[model samples]
Target: MYSIDETYKNIEAEFKPRSKWDQGVKETALAVLDSLDMPETVLPDHFGSRRALLLNGADNWREYSYGGCALVYNVDIAARFFTPSEMRRYMADGHDASMAFRGEPLLDLQARALSQAERVISRYAREH
Candidate 1:
């Protein structure tokens, strides 16, 4: 039942680091969140209605994504989730497709993430 702000605070504290780079990145993320006009409460359906979560990335993104998914799952907000590169090849084809025609690595990653998010949302809508 934590508000999004409270959840973010908890995450910030959990990610507090001794390394300068990590600390800086965490601070930047929190600052961006703080500047946004967000809802005071976390919506019940914030993670989607059908309980499927798709998270992308390999390194830091994977860690943070898994952590958030675990937190939501702990609170009964997520029933199932998968980190990128964990599933079968067939299941990963869509993500691969997102990178097919992209030139830049960053743009390809962004497109892949967007594609995955849209897929998750659409699948959730259909299943629920």
Candidate 2:
């Protein structure tokens, strides 16, 4: 299994940042990855699948969602604040929330993302 640092480096090399928000998210993602303790044990399946999704997006620039933002958010949050089981639960809940609105009201998605960001930021702050 690849270490989280190795996985993150691979991701950074593969996904070019296009905007300030994109660049911030990428940098934050790497910071979150670096903060992980048992990075080798976390998100084995999810990380691989998400990385593949990102690679696909990189190969086809027209595909928007696969570009790693949501994947980064999910993995970062899971690594920082959740157990494997809770990670699955919250991720499914977030997906369900998004689907219930037919992707409109994007507030649900934004809330989920913001919650993840807040948690990761707070944890990083407390640790450092």
Candidate 3:
């Protein structure tokens, strides 16, 4: 999903496995979804969780910063629901609500994500 030039270098780093705690947190989150029979294939993957991780771990975010905000787009995930251009058009390519979640523990974030997912899914089921 990345261009084959300078982005390739960044891709190499992005593919690095999550550290131990991240791995554990992600697994537990996924397991929670599974326990509820909410398969990822059929459910939403919000940009919220991904955004927090990326920006919190961002190296020299200062390089991208302007007016204390930076344009941070995760094309790999956004492409699932929006094109890069569409994302920028809709402000999806910029910092968003998820920024408020910075410094939160992974488990706390996961619990909220799962709760939100469950609420949305349940609402959808009722309306449909």
TM-score of each: 0.31, 0.34, 0.25
The better-scoring model by lDDT among 2 and 3 is: 2
Q: Which 10 consecutive positions of candidate 3 have the poorest summed lDDT?
A: 63-72
Model 1, runs deviating above 4 Å: 43-128
In model 3, how large is the Cα lDDT of residue 105? 28
Q: Tell me the tens digit of each residue's lDDT in model 2 across 8-124.
A: 655566657564444545554565455454455433345445344333333331222234433334344344434456546646744652332333333333334433433333333
Q: List the candidate 2 regions with Cα displacement exceeding 4 Å.
A: 46-128
In candidate 1, residue 44 scores what lDDT?
Answer: 39
**Candidate achieving higher TM-score, 1 or 2:** 2
Q: For candidate 3, give the lDDT of residue 52.
A: 37
Q: What is the lDDT of residue 105 in candidate 1?
A: 34
Cα shift from native, residue 50, model 3 (Å): 28
In terms of TM-score, how similar is model 2 to the real structure?
A: 0.34
Candidate that scores best on lDDT: 2
Q: Give the distance in Å from residue 18's predicted Cα in candidate 1 to where it truly belongs.
A: 1.9
Question: What local lDDT score does residue 66 receive in model 2, on the 0 to 100 scale?
Answer: 36
lDDT of 1 by residue, 44-106 (tens): 344542122223222333343344422222112111222223224314446652232224333
Worst 10 residues of 2 by lDDT: 119-128
Which pairs of residues have clashing backbones in candidate 3? none
Error of 1 at 67 (Å): 28
Q: Best by TM-score, which number?
A: 2
